[model samples]
Target chain A: MKPESAVVSITVNGTPHRLEADTRRTLVDLLREDLGLTGTKIGCGQGTCGACTVHVDGVRVLACLLLAVTVEGGQVLTIEGLGTPDGGLHELQQAFIDRDALQCGFCTPGQIMSGLGCIGEGRANTAEEIRESMSGNLCRCAAYPGIVAAIADVAEGQGA
Target chain B: MRPFEYARPSDLAQALAAAGPDTVFIAGGTTVVDLMRLDVLAPRRLVGLGDVAELRRTELDGDPVRLGAGVTMAEAAALPLVRERYPALAAAIDLAASAQIRNVATLGGNLLQKTRCPYFRDASSPCGRRRPGDACSALTGHLEQRAVLGASPHCVAPYPGDMAVALVALEASVEAATAAKVVTVQVADLFREPGDAPHKETVLGDGDIITAVLLPAPRGTSAFVKLRDRASFAFAAASAAVSLELDHDRVVAARIALGGVATRPWRSSEAESAVSGERLTPERAFAAGEAAFEAVARTHENRRGIALGARAVTAALLACRGG
Candidate 1:
């Protein structure tokens, strides 16, 4: 049976998008599927993995757990919203490259987004704090040390 | 996922009106969305409570600290009053899920969140909690994470939330609102032990919405200690929440609750009684912990949880003493 779709509007990276989204469609699905923003990855599909982390109203949330229609008239910031590949990378993204924070790169988007939120919340003052705050985004490749370094660097005004 | 109608009502009355036998209310969708994706829960109508702003209010001015049902775990944990007045509650909320999840997971949803028992989650497995009269796979398959204190022949799935354990120890009351009236119920009485009907988890009636949770004024020093597989982003293997009132070195009053070792938020009046009138000592605390799990029935794999739970209780009690 086909799920009924609803007309929902949200500002994605300063661009207002009005689309007909399935009521059951998650925020991640809305970004990756309907909006053609494939940066947000769905790892566990459950809220367990933070691979689908995104900013809703400037607060970081698990996109996989949020319904698309629930964020009507809200501002959403995904990985693609952070920086452009051709233009320039965000400081955090640059720090990640410099620090080699990623290995397989599957969990990098979530790590960067969560790191941005951690820094924005002023929770990345110390390495321990960075590690604790970024515990949501799991990296199976064991690139935690580098990721922590990159986040710590960006947090301490050492990046970009 | 099964197709479901979504309704975002602007008021509580509309939200209630939209709810029916086949309807389920969603706050942050941390638990409901996950279950829906897993096909564990497939409600025909999804009633969104996001627009009901009254449910998100947090009032901590006086006697009973009122936390609206939609108060997110992050908001509750970050509240200075909640941290100072009810450290156990704050700690429990802080120790749950992750930063991203905590930002959106509501207090009401946390209490109503289902067990993380592998069998209950995996639809293919025979789970008495997920499917009535189904053989509990956790009973024999993997008993390590199963409940020990509140086990029945039918189910051994442990209640997975840390906030409820703290709330129960704090002697909190939940204000449940229905179409007709509102009734306040003790937090400890909210959950039903999984017996013949493991699927029936809570005592909430049809269309009963938890509006707020009222927490009594802080009596004494409280602490929450959780032992889990990892340091963060994991459910407790054994956890304890203790609130103790002491005169000098002697315990005047104590409330003890254990989690991750029971089918529900297990509050031990026996443990509270054991600690009362006794000096805050390691031996006494250990004895009180033992009293809490005196009649605990453990499976072959989860026997360690019994000992671990006792240790957690003792540790929390000692922490309350500033030891």
Candidate 2:
């Protein structure tokens, strides 16, 4: 049988969209394929790696594990939404650049998104805490030291 | 993945009404989505429990602490009351998965999460736990992740979860809404060992919906210790949840539960007996740990896991003593 579809009304970043998506389509697929927001990377589709991390209703969650239809009424914040009001880079994004947090830059978006979540959740107080909290987003390039430094810089308001 | 219809039920009644043999209730979708993608579970219909507001509560101040089934692991673990009173449960939630997973994975879904057995998760493999008559591939493939306790000939896949172990040690109960009426099941009894039917993991009926998890008042000083391949974001290779009530120096009561080495969340009566009436010294703690795994099926494949299981018990007990 063909997959069922649902007309979903969701808010992405600051924009609202009503899209007809297959019930089986994951949130990551919906964001990248349907909405063309390719900033969020899909590392492991089975939730093992946190490359598809995004914010749904201000909570950090794996997009691959969530069905797009299940988040019908949710407000999603993707990596593309982290820019400032003046079109400048977000503090965390600038911190990532300043700290050289990316070697290959594939996991950088997810790292930045999850870094915002960690700071919001008060898990970015120390370098150890930042590493433990950001353990979800894996950078295969092994840029963890710079990632921790970038998140800590923003969390401590030093990068601002 | 097979095509499936989805329904977002707003309440418990509607959710239970939609339940059937071909239907699955999904909250966080961490396990269901993963398994569905693997073609392990191809339910025709999925009832989304995310919109059910009544099941998302966190009532921790009452006598019998009640945590709604829809409450996310991150939400529950962040509560100061949980960390202060039930350290084992808090630690269990904290140590279970990554930050992003805990943010969406609910307490109820975590308890029902499927085994990480490579054979069970792969659709191409013949797994007794996935199909009733199929052979368990883990028996001949890899024994490192197989269960050492409560394993039947049909299946040796261990239950891969953390919170359930602490709940069993804390004597928690689960409240559910069935088609006929509401019922409460003990956390320990909720999970079934791999007996003749390895597929029957729980006693829940087709239409049964878990509503809440009830926890008793804090026992004595409690701790949860987990040993895994990685320091973070990995399933436990061997773990122990221990709660000890000390009368000055002697033990008044003790509850010991083991995970990662058992087919289910295992309560060790042998370990309880070893330390209940005696003072909990380091030697006594080590003895209790050994008692926990004394009856386990020891093999060359699981020798290291058994040793780690014993050491986990010892570490948890000593941690409860503030050592």
Candidate 3:
């Protein structure tokens, strides 16, 4: 028996790659283990936790539940591929670092991804709205008020 | 996880043939993959259905909006049409898990997903529904959120999808398929009254796959009011999706469905008809809400469902009047 495996070609962090994987292998595993993109954390293997968040064709998806085959011809962006690193950081990333929004920093990537989604979709208009939109990304340290303030700062700044 | 053969078919016909006796089709895989990891589903051949282009469109054909089963809850809610015409459906999608899960979770998987019953999750607990012939743990353990309607004596597990509640209230239908046949069943008629077959949730059998959910176009007024423990992402404790038709300020037609409180997606057309033709004043709307749960059999934990469901009905009914 030629051990049953799925062959999928996907674009990760703007690079195209193909691999053979078991049906059970999550997109997160393929990203971290195979592609060497470990910026996407694995908080809860189940869908409840947002640690494994990544942008799939501009939409944030839980990497653990995402099958690599689903994104065969689609674009994927992990935290490593987020911004021009030598050119400083993305606005949300700068907000987190500037405001001390991150405590242990485990949830910062997921938080930034979700915040980007929020800002991109025009849902994070106010502090309350930012909090609601960012509810999916959990910080065990409960560093939420600062997170909200940082995201809200950007939203308000954009308006003024 | 048991190593299994995997094939991604691009279209429906290829998907149909691949869904043979030993093969099970996977879409989204939020639920099935979980079960597979837990050793609940043990098929030797797994068919992946993500590339079926037809299963991802949300289009209005004739009367209803048909959502391809592959469409994610997040994607469906983002559709401008659903946001304008069916806020309940959009709200239900929003209230399901969280933005991350919603993006990856498909409409078909959400509907076809299995129980949250702790015993069933255990796999060894052997609820009659989980195994061929075993005792129902829901009857003994926490049975508050168990089904009050259409529950078989052997199984009273609640149908745990919020979208199903809104769709049932909106009079939606679902398309199901297996290698042998393809068919449509009203969302209302999908879940059978629990009888001897405790494991079976809907008319779809072992080999069948849900293809799409057809949502009848909005006729009157509708809203979904869900009450949960958290203001954030959580399942409904008891919720109501109400669609009411008003004539000259009086309700002429009503469709009511309950969520997080029943075995199947609970729709009470009788309760809706009770307030039909009555002025949808606060009093009448309240009365209609109360009437919706007339025969609701409550257990130790979910006595709150009846009252909460009534309040939800009033809220949804008020939404119909749209200020």
Highest DockQ among the candidates is held by which one? Answer: 2
Residue B178, model 1: lDDT of 84
Q: Point out where model 3 deviates above 4 Å.
A: A85-87, A157-160, B178-182, B297-299
Worst lDDT window (10 residues) for model 1 chain B?
A: B294-303
| lDDT of candidate 1 over A100-135, digit per residue (tens) | 998899988999999999998888888888888888
TM-score (chain B only), all candidates:
0.97, 0.98, 0.92
* Candidate closer to the true structure by TM-score (higher is better), 1 or 2: 2
Off by over 4 Å in 2: A1-3, A158-160
lDDT of 1 by residue, B1-323 (tens): 88888888998888878879778899988999989888898889898899998787667885688999998898889888888889999999988999999998899999999998888888888988887889889877866677877778889889999999999999999998888888899999999998888888989876889999899988988999999888788999999999889999899999999999899999999888888999989999999988887776445666688788889999999999897
Q: Which lDDT tens digits does candidate 3 get at residues B141-208?
A: 77656665666668878777789889898898998877777789998888765687777768887667
Worst 10 residues of 2 chain B by lDDT: B293-302
Candidate 2 per-residue lDDT over residues A61-92, each given as its tens digit: 99999999888889999989989888999989
Model 1 CA lDDT for position A70 = 82
By DockQ: ranked, best first: 2, 1, 3
lDDT of 2 at B255: 94
Cα deviation of A131, candidate 1, in Å: 1.4
Model 1's CAPRI class? medium
RMSD of 3: 2.3
Interface RMSD of each: 1.4, 1.2, 1.7
Weakest 10 consecutive residues, lDDT, candidate 1 chain A? A1-10
lDDT of 3 at B28: 75
Q: Pick the candidate with the highest lDDT.
A: 2
